[model samples]
Target: MKLALSALGLAVLTGCAAVSPQQGVDRANDEAAGFTQGALNLARTQQERDDRAQKTQTLLSAPVGQKEAVQLALANSAALQALLAQGWVDAAGAAQLGRVANPVFSFERMSSGGSLDLGRALSFGLLDLLTLPARQGIATRRIEEAQLRLTGDVVDQVTAVRQAWVRAVAAQQTASYAQQVYQSAEAGAELARRMRAAGNFNRIDRAREQSFYADAATRLATARHQATASREELVRLLGLDEAQAGALRLPERLPDLPKQALEPQAVASLATRARLDIRLAQSALDSASKAQGLGVVTSFTDIELTGRRNTAFDADGTRSNARGWEIAVALPIFDWGGMQRAAMNGRTLAAANQLEATVRAAGSSLRQSYSAYRTSYDIARHYRDEVVPLRKLISDENQLRYNGMLIGVFELLADARDQVGTVLAALDAQQQFWLADAALQASVVGRPGGATVASPAAAPAESASAGH
Candidate 1:
């Protein structure tokens, strides 16, 4: 009885304990902060969610910048909240798997000729109890995997927000230039009409001016629509309502290019430590290895042990007691676990291959991202330093010639229109560079955003040549 009592005490103490999902969530938020530079959280209670909503309101109350936009999404996005809640459920389910199956209880009674007998039995899976520690290890690993996955998801979301902000702001700037071009064309067309009425301009020349005005109007319309569409895209990502969208204000232009491009060596170094894909793959491989080992014992056979007790009373008033235990083992005669073992082996092999593939691909992926980053930087820089300045100089010279009566008013108006087009192209180049920059940052951190570098806008010289 003493031995049994001691064993019972040990079993009770060693039983699996419940794990809180907050532990994993907190870990994920911490790791994600390094990449997103914003707070990520799971609002488990109504009060917590309300608090986040209030914070989101505060952010949207002002003109939202890129960083502020990320914060707003983190606070306001229902989808992100759902991801967190689902992550908790997944982690809790994994914890439950590590726990021992509930024990079975049985009771029996018999009465005959004034004799009474009772039996009680309690049973549980013996093998599961023996392997509880291994199962717990597997569960821990699964929780880590969940945390890493959450971090990766946050990184992706934040990257999207940044890129969306860039596009919206660039579109706004482009639309302004488009409007200027339209107004200039309208003025020139009106002047041509008046000159034609006075017999100073021919019909062909007047029609050419009208055609330019018509094209400018179309381009202006397209640009305005593009700006609205991009702004709405940002609004959706940030989870803003109509009122909040109205309050949102973007920068006048895209940010200037960085002073120096990221070095290839720096990118390679970050990829080695920061790649989440490789980390996830490695975690999966570890999980498969642990699972395969655990499966070997469970697939072969199962064991159930039961501690039983009985009592009996006779007609003469004499009482008796009985106590014993039973062990039930599954026999491996008719069905062996060949298929189970085969599946386990296959899973292990697949995991190994996946890890290898991720490792091999990581460097190449970083290299490609870096190439885009560098190329975009160069193109945008060229436009800023070479193309825009030359256009400005040419416009200045044309203005001077017009003042001297060396060029006609039509020639001056055309030059002004061309200069606006050059500015529009420059804005596009700047937007593409920033988008590429955001994508490169995401790739450096292990969640590849798959950012594509848009082709650089045609140079003003090229446009002039093509016209000739």
Candidate 2:
């Protein structure tokens, strides 16, 4: 009875505590500070909503940078709020497992031939009381798992926002360049027409020039549409309403690549601490191992204890009272809980293997992400320092040669046309570098966003157009 009272007191203390959604959001903000930029919130009131809206507006008032975009999404996204709420719900459910069910009370009364009888009983699950401490341990691990999941999910969401912002800004930059290319092609085509009419340019050369102009127009249209699509995608990820969508602005260009790529040792150091996947898997294994141990006793049978009191009265006004305790154990004669024990064993084994798998894969995934990052950084740097400058040099020399009358205007125009592909390809390389950078940030935190490299020949088909 003393032990029962002690366990009941423990259960009462654990049961009365409430789980707060803001707590989970705050935890995520702390754990995923790099991804969330420490701006995560869950607005449960009108005041908070207004404050969040104002913050989002302030962010959208300027051209959204990569980090600012992630901050805005954390502040404004309803889906993110739902995620926090769901995490709270999961945490509460896990906490519920640590508490014992309320004790049951029973009452009965009967009268026969002026004789009266009354009975009362109180009952509870004895197994639940005995296992309270173990159950609480399991609940603690599950709650930990929930928090890690919340942090990992926030990291993924913020990583997506960052990548989308990069794509949108890059697409906007490319579109502007495409427009410039189209205008230049149009001018060259008109000049070619005039030269051909004056009999200074051949029919085939004029046709090629016109074909280039047509292709440029097509490419410009595609680029504009691509820009629109990318911007809309960003808007969606940021959870913008119609007014907010209209007010959205993206940077005119992708940010310049870092001067130096992250060192391998630095990356290893970053990934070594608090990786979400490994921690989550370890939490699962802990919960499963604890639950399996508890299941060994619970799966075979259940024990219930009841305290009973009875009273009887005769017609002569005499009364007698009876009091005792009863212990009930479930009979496992026909159906033992073999399947329940088997399932628990299987889950424990699965969790152990999963932790091992995550441990083995973590380093490899980080390496792949780093490789993509470095490769992209190198390619973009090569274009910036080598290919683009070489193209500009060629264009400038051609213009000087034309001024000296060593080359015809047609040849000068052809040289300019050839430079278009190089410029666009350089833009593509820069875009991939930024995207890879975003993915690498995510992978370091253990949420493996892919960082696939674009092919070297990412320029449009018109870049390969024939030149005379």
Candidate 3:
């Protein structure tokens, strides 16, 4: 059954992903057919993804002095450090497991001459016979589990940094807009106060203009504070100290969000096909099953080989040599069959429970992720299509009314404030959509919208890991 599942794992729940792009799926299949070639294809795909990101950066207007932040994050991020340690542990474990246990030997001696009595001794030269294999299997599984977890962590951190970058840029733009509105409001308020003092207008006009200026000032201050906080967050995430942060430049632009969006079913399929947490649990079950087999063998089989040496003596003090070999097995009678069975049963049960838990947790997470990603996508789309356009129309109308003197200067300033607010809100909506995108990609197997990664149970999912 395990072997059958192993084959089925690579095939997916229905033997293939229901939502994968045909070209990428075909490419994955081709890679599956040839080990080295498959690796080459993956490498090529990754390089292309990197190249695209680099190109995209040139078009975006990011902050200045962000280099120090990047350098710091690369050096001090706890997530990255933990990942590196896991990789080293995995390497040592693999080496130990792959290596063979040294052979065993036994020595024998005769107690007396002319007597068949022999001396028996027991010693284990290959104590590694058990520890090595057991430790190796555990290590290999650890590597897979670690790699999967680390991949998700790194992706999460990257997404976080990108989101902060997006927000920081938006905040700066908002502050710039707010200041513009404030300047116009101040001018209008002064004009209205003069007109009221000269008996040309009522106090209402002057008061409204002053209110507009106050509102713009509040918003501008808020925007400045937000930008500052976001900048600091980016720097901290990049692992820089305060001094290094001071030397950093803000990003010039943010990476574009994945142009393509996944449907709910696609995200669900992705979670199942590529989620490493689930794979790690499945591998643990396999390791447990293997351990049960070893336990069963140990409990039943008392395997031993013995040797003896003896000398027959005439009435003389000289001894003649004799040697013999004997193989022995212990007959089970009072030994703990129930205890062995109990232990094996527990291990097997735990394995089943673990796999079950992982599948359930992954399914639940997928459902939540798909919904959030879809919601963000739809909201951002709505802002772009409906809200932003309406705000712009309002602004244009306000401008015309001001030109015709049908509306006062305060009314025009009000429209300007609203337009700036709408743009900032739209920007936030869009950035959130990208954050959701990062999460879904982390759940999947690679950078967003590029390739299909499939986890096959072909020989235990643990064997299908990278940097392990």
- The top-ranked prediction according to lDDT is 2
Give the higher-lDDT candidate: 2 or 3. 2
Model 3's alpha-carbon lDDT is 0.53
Best by TM-score: 2
Candidates 1 and 3 compared: the better one by TM-score is 1
lDDT of 2 by residue, 1-468 (tens): 864895678667567434677777888888887777677887889999999999999998998888888888989998888888888998888778888878888998999998999999888898888988899889888888888898888888888888889889988998999999899889999998998899987888888889889989998999999999999999989999999999898778888888899999998888747799999999999999999999999988999999899999998989999999999999989869899999999999999999999999888889999999999999999999999999899899989988998888777777887887888889889989888988998899888876799886455444333344
Clashing pairs in 2: none
* True-vs-predicted CA distance for residue 266, candidate 2, Å: 1.9
Root-mean-square deviation of every model: 3.2, 2.4, 14.8
Each prediction's Cα lDDT score? 0.81, 0.86, 0.53
Please, what are the lDDT tens digits per residue for candidate 1 over residues 259-358?
9888888777766484688888888888889989999998999999998999999988899999999999999998789899899999999999999998
Instruction: Give the poorly placed runs of model 2, Cα more than 4 Å off.
Output: 1-13, 16-18, 197-199, 461-468
Candidate 1 TM-score to native: 0.90
What's each prediction's TM-score?
0.90, 0.94, 0.60
Clashing pairs in 1: none
What tens-digit string does per-residue lDDT give for candidate 3 at 151-176? 44444555565556556655665566
Weakest ten-residue segment in model 2 by summed lDDT: 459-468
